[model samples]
Target chain A: MNTLDARGYSCPEPVIMTKKALEKGLPLTVMVDGVTPLNNITRFAQNKGYKVESRAVGEDYELTISK
Target chain B: MKNKQTLLIAATGLVVGALAVLLTLNGNPANMGFCIACFLRDTAGALGLHKAAVVQYARPEIIGLVLGAFIMSVAGKEFAAKGGSSPMTRFVLGFFVMVGALMFLGCPLRMVLRIAGGDLNAVVGLIGFVCGILGGIFFLKNGFTLKRTYTLSRLEGTWMPILSLGVLALLLLAPSLLAFSESGPGSMHAPVMMAQAAGLIVGALAYKTRLCMVGGIRDAVLFGDFYLLYGFVAIIIAALIGNLAIGSFNLGFDGQPVAFNDGLWNFLGMALTGLGSALLGGCPLRQLILAGSGNSDSAVTVMGMIVGSAFCHNFGLASSADGPTSAGKIAVIIGFAVVIVIGLANMRKEKV
Candidate 1:
């Protein structure tokens, strides 16, 4: 599993970057802050039907997706 | 000229726009509300031109609007192929307009409808739009002009309708490539045929009436004309009723579906849209109508809108379900500067 630290990115950057990461065909973990990013990234992964697990960690979030 | 004719057009536009929204609720897209700007943005997303990932679809209403308007133009013999008025500038304006609308999370039509639906942030947006359009009017009064267009061969203009047809064909044949959202904003859509029919009806009426919010406001302010602006009011009344009937009126900005409540950005974003639409000579819907009539300038504007959506999504300038991004704010600032420069540099001085 590859982990993406998207803590600093906003809006579509995290979504776009995650899309780029997915092009490499790997299970992934994306760390984000706030519910909007979580919703965007979660929707992105779920739209592609990637298995995802999300949990809150401090002020940030950890989202794990499996290929 | 005639009250009956005006009333007919306004009523038809209202019904068609409302039906478009209701259809969106059934299966098309949520809160779409007959916006060429937003539909073109979504079309850009469906093509993977930009990976917003949340809002992507080859909206049938967009296709329907162009095709519908084309049919009306042909039937009425009002179709004339013309263009070449600072095409590149118009394209950029269209693009920036989309970026601004996305930042506010809706187009001009949707902006008004959102307000009618009780989203108070739209009040800020509407104010911004009016102010922006008034700014464009100032440029106009000072002799800001895009180059005039001459007639083009009819065959050349037919290509836009053909392109729309091709899109419709792709939508029906390879639906998967359209890339609808399964669980987000894109997941919400009006029914396809219903949406298309609504668009077709609205396009036809708008083609006849020259229905455009920016044009309406600009004309009212600049020329003391209120005919076109009345249609805008009609749409608000109709959409408000529809929202009430559907139980979607929320009366606040905080939790409105498909909208964000960042007051400053909301105001500025729509102001940018209003200004751009004014400079381009029409709102997004009017641009589509112009394109259908073979105005390549409008076509270029439409293309620019699609590209702008791609740029906004890819560059983090678009607002999301959460709110507007910082990049979106910066882009709006830059976009405003760009519009100001375009207006100033392109102003034509009267020859002695």
Candidate 2:
């Protein structure tokens, strides 16, 4: 399992970063703000067959992916 | 695999569109609802690019769509900076697309919104668009070719994003340059930052997903690809939900905002745009994204849209809420003929 942080990033940035990390072909964790980035990242993850879970942590969202 | 991709693309478009509609409900405007064409038209006016006083404003959706595309491209490692195709031809096609869009006073996206809003006129315009697209498909099948492009330096394709950033700077630092309507359709707007932010994000996402209405239809019709088309459907559904949420659902054609009562011209105008987009290989939104990715051809098309707006307004070829100008009707006819001639003429004598 691998973890990537994107908490302070804006929409698409977090998603894009998460995607970049996923290119390593390992289960990963992504953090993002707002509903949009979450949707984008989660969809990307789900499509790739990575198991995913999300929870609101204070001001932002934390999403963890596993395969 | 294709179904999943289709669902993702369409769902993303729907979510983005719904968010855009939410912006409108919070004081944006009606049936304007969510349109890249109308918004770009307003942005042009805000820059005093045209004197159509009733329809100018700095549209956030346009800004958001591009920036959104940029962000995704950069993040996903897919933002390959590249450009150079038949720039002048692309520009002319873009201009004609805008001309046609103004005739209808809406692009493909708006056509969808119109249908969602229950405007029967849009149904006619959509049929025209399909006919035009079919025509373009014919050209495509017959080896009508725009030359293959060579990838350009990254900085070359970064011009649109830089320009967008400049617009944002102007919006925030020099507000006076943006024309605001004292009354009428131009006066209505969501907040400047909000509009820009939304546009930027949507643009970036669209760039990454390659969510193009023109490509969606073309691919579906020509190649049997449905990924992009799904995004097109998503936008309508999201817009409907957003309209419902904001109590802006009108459900009929009697009185749509920023749209005219002319039906035939609307059909012709959208038909022109549809054909132009098909020939050019992307919608206006796709053009912007391509420009962001360093495609000079797309940049040229965008330039055409800017110039076409000027021509549409100056020559009285643009429609108003009341209806299409007589000049606009003539322009639509001439515009269509001109595009047909150019498209056929541009075909290479030898297959590339």
Query: Candidates' lDDT values, in order?
Result: 0.78, 0.74
lDDT of 2 by residue, B1-352 (tens): 4466566687678867776676666567666655767777777888888887887777766766666777776776556554455778888898899999988978887787777666778888888898888888777665465555555688877787788778778777888868877777678877766666667767766775777778777766764545577888888888777677767777666687677667788778889999998888878878877676556677778888988987888789888778888898888788889888877886757432
For every model shown, the clashing-pair count is 9, 26
Docking class of 1: incorrect
Supply the TM-score of chain A against the true chain A for every candidate structure: 0.89, 0.78
What value does the lDDT take at residue B259 in candidate 1?
79
Q: Encode model 2's per-residue lDDT on A1-67: one tens digit a residue.
A: 6678765332223544576677776667776644445765776677667788899886467888888
lDDT of residue B214 for candidate 2: 82
Distance from true position, residue B43, model 1, in Å? 1.1
